[model samples]
Target: MRVGIIGFAGSGKTTIFNALAGIGGDVAPGKAGRINLREVQVPDARIDKLSLMYQPKKTIYASIQLADLPGQAPGSGGGFDANSIAKMREMDLLVIVARAFDNPYINAPIDPASEIGGMLAELLLADYTVVEKKVMRLRKEAAKGTERDLFEQLFATLEAEQWLSTLELSEQSLELLTGFRLLTLKPVLVVLNTPEDKADHDSASELIEPLSSFEAPIFALSAKLEAEIAELDPEEQLAFLAEIGIQGTARDRFIRAAYKSLDLISFFTVGEDEVRAWTVQRGANAQTSAGKIHTDLSKRFIRAEHMTCADLIELGSEAKVKEAGKFSLKGKEYITQDGDILHIRAS
Candidate 1:
């Protein structure tokens, strides 16, 4: 999935993006419409343990794609550039960085609440524009029925400055609105960029608590402090986190936030040849999830020999798990669970 990093100028989004992607993402100021894209592996200790146990020729971890966009201050006469808006439309999720720290270069007062609120308004305005234009065009054409009615309902919601996602729509209405790609409909994660002195994970709770109305995942970290450390190797990174007294790296926290916001889970496939982690929706069925591994597996799916990663680790082997009756064969309709190690049996 592609996630966009966005915020107003001097919010340190590039630093956050670099931290998340493990890259030196730098763009010269005053460059309009620039977007930097990078894909980073989603860190999971489960994959590490499985890799160690299997001694695989190769280990594969699921990755998330990130895009960092040029910072644009909201309420500016010129809103998001057409190109920037287009780029945002292509993203599956949005990460809005709000400034809570003082930056000497940024002249404006630091108000994360106002910054995020204004940015959300921008998104609402953008969507409202699209719906309004559509509704007007339909009226001009003397259009009536579900199509007009749907957008009319959307108009009322957007008119109130609420996200389109708040409206409950049928499958048909959802399909109809799919083409618009409303910005507010995308899952959002809010990150507060705070001063180094206040970098403690819980320090920004007050700032975040009031934002509960956004109904998005929220967290705080000092991007400037974490950016450089993100370049370190895994062992060194862990050492640094311990030294800094933070529970985890900024990247791991951000990944967890995104995963929770999206209701995602990872399943594994292990062998001597390869050990890989695959991400899927929480409640995806066995055959549906088999398609994440391979289409052929889903097409010819028989039954999956499923065992929990915890079971394997506890019992010390697949044989032991089977001996304990912890390994069972599940049919196509079986709901996939987190950390399930699946061996798909296909024709």
Candidate 2:
């Protein structure tokens, strides 16, 4: 999954990125767009336990790609460049990093809630612009007597653009609009960057007045503090977070939450050669998920036998697991559950 981090100027977007991805982007305000891509291992307690139990030659974990997009200050008109918008369009999820700390002399410092409200408006405007442009093109095509079904459908959607968000369209309407790729329709994750001293502040209460209309989940973190904490040794990091009364790392929570937001889940393929985790959407069945591993696996697909990692760990061995009659055979239509260890049999 590709997650793009964006916020207003001096919102500590890069700090959040570095904390999450272990990158030290310079701490400068008003910097232009600089895209940083990093693959983050998806933390799973079950995987760790299994690795310890098996002592395999190699231990592999599932991973997702994160993109640290530059800070976007739409109020200053410095945020949305053509390239930046295009980059955002390529993301599967958006992480809006909001500034909640006070920094004297910062070029842009506004109420985090207010800033986020304005940012959402800007995103909506950007989508509206795209929709308007497409509508105009379709109009020209219609005037020239073009009679494509897709264009006609697009024209109808463009007419209802004012109430697009409110229209609870049927499956058919949704399927028709799926190809448009409207940015406003994408899921949003709001990350509120708080002061180090107040990292655990109740953002829901703090943001109640300013963000009453926003329906997205809000996560609070100390971006600058987390970035500094991440640079320390693992032991020191744990000690530091404990001293600060932090129970878990924000990066892990962000990644896991982002995974859920994108409707993604993990499955595993284990062997002495390589035991690796793979990601696919939650509802994806066996055949569709096999395609994620390799086209060849999907092409030669027959049936899949499945067992849970938990069952294997409890049973002590694969031999014992099979002997216990826990293994089950599933057809292509079998929807994969998270933590399932799959072995596909194909001819």
Candidate 3:
């Protein structure tokens, strides 16, 4: 999945990006309408254990593509540039960074709610403009079809300042609206960049309490602190986190939140040669999941030899798991679960 990091100027968007992507050093301020893309491996302890047990020659983890888009300048008023909006429209999710930290360079007070409110309003305005223009074009051409009706419905939602994602529409309507790439239709995760000295402060909660009405997933972290932690070795990092009484790094929390926001899960394929984690939607069935590995496996239409990772771990090996009757044969219609170890049987 692809996620975009977006926020207003001085909101610490790049700092979050660097922390999550494990990149360090100076990030030159991005120009308006530019996108910085990076690929990050999704951390999974299950894969690490499997690799150790199987002695695989190659081990691969599921990854996500992250785009760091330039921040919207405060009071730009006209909304985001067309290029930036187009890039963001292609993302599966958005991570909005709002500043709650005091910076010597910034004169504004640390008001996360207001920053987020302005950013969200701009997103709504951008969608409204797109929908309005589309509806007008359709009307000018006197168009009469599913596409026009779809735009009309979208326009209605945008007019009310409601996200299209919140509206329930038929599958046909949804398919018709796919080309529009409405910004507000995508899932959002709000990140409040708290001050480093007050990383565990209760002020973050107060700042976000009013935004509960939006009902989006919200988290608070000290991006500056996280960036510093990212520069440490693993052992040092753990010690530092313990010193601060933080359970985990911001990267882990952010990635987990991103996965949850997208409703994604991971399935595994294991062998002596390779142990890999594969990503799929939560409700994907055996056949659909096989396609994620290989189309031929799906086309041949056979069964899957599967067992949960927990079973394998407890039983010590695939042979032991099979001996215990923990390994079962699943047909194409069987729904795949997270942490399932699957072996496709095909022609």
Candidate 4:
């Protein structure tokens, strides 16, 4: 999975990216820089439990790649460079960092609602531009009597742009466009850069109201504070978070939110040699997900013994899980669940 961090200038987007990915990207004020890439480990409580149970020589977790691109400054520094927008179009999700913090030196003033609105409009406009140009070219070709399927698809795309531009689509219509990779249709996680002291303030409740209609989840965090906390030891960080009434680290929560936003789920392959987590989109089948590990594993064509991680933990071991009949044989067509542990038997 991939997520891109975007916003207007001085929204602490780079700071949030640094906090999550442990990269020291240039967070200097008003100094936009090149895109930074980081692979963040997917946070899973079940992985921690499996680590204790199996004590594998190598433990691996699924990762989501993040790209921190420079903010969109319309009418300045070559507004929305064609290259950069094209790069962002490949991302699986979007984390829009909106400025809500009170800081004098900020590159842009704090207007949380407007920043979000502007970002959404920018994405919509970008997608509309791409689709329009493509449709125009396709229209010329269709005039020469192209095949029916090809014409139908081109017209469908044209209609998508038409409908998305005019109507405020409900959640269902928005979901139907997921495969299109339309910039406006990507799942957005709005990160509010709030003051450290008022991390959980309810003042922004009204500000977040409009986002409800878009079906995007809103998260508030002090990016600077989170970056600082990330440098501390694990115990110290937990204590600090407790004192601040933060239930958990923003990095963890953000990672989780991004994972869920992409409609992805995790399944595990466990052993003393290695315990690894793999990610696949929701509704992915066993055979396709196995391909993620290796082509040979997926092609071997055999049944899998599947059991829940929770069942393994409760049963104390794989041996006990089998004795309790919690382990069941699943065919290649079986849909993997979020916390499934699979032991494949291939010929």
lDDT of 3 by residue, 1-347 (tens): 99999988778888888888888554555355566799999999999989989999999999999998978775555567778788888999988998888856566777777778887887888899988998999999999988888889889988988888888888887777688777888899999888886564354577667777765788888888988888889999999999988878878888998999999999999999999999999999999999999999999969999999999988889999989989899999999999999999998
- Local accuracy of candidate 2 as per-residue lDDT tens digits, 32-99: 56777888888888878777776789888888788888666535864477787788888888888887
lDDT of 3: 0.86
Among all candidates shown, the one with the greatest lDDT: 3
The CA lDDT at 289 in model 4 is 81
Candidate 3: RMSD to truth: 1.8
Q: Is candidate 1 or candidate 4 better by lDDT?
A: 1
Q: Write the per-residue lDDT of candidate 1 for residues 1-347, one digit (tens) a residue.
A: 88898889778888888878777444344543567789889988888999989999999998888898877864464567767777888888898999888877667888788888877877788888889999899889999899999988999898887888887789899898888888988888888888876675677677677777767677888887777677678799789879878888777888988888878899999999999999898999999999999999999999999999999988888999999999999999999999999999999
**What is the TM-score ranking, best to worst?**
3, 1, 2, 4
Clashing pairs in 3: none
| Cα lDDT tens digits for candidate 4, 225-315 | 8888877888998999999788888888888888888889999999999989999999988888888888887999598789999999888
Cα lDDT, all candidates: 0.85, 0.76, 0.86, 0.77
Model 4 TM: 0.87
Which 10 consecutive positions of candidate 4 have the poorest summed lDDT? 145-154
| Poorly placed runs, candidate 1 (over 4 Å) | 24-32, 74-77, 209-213
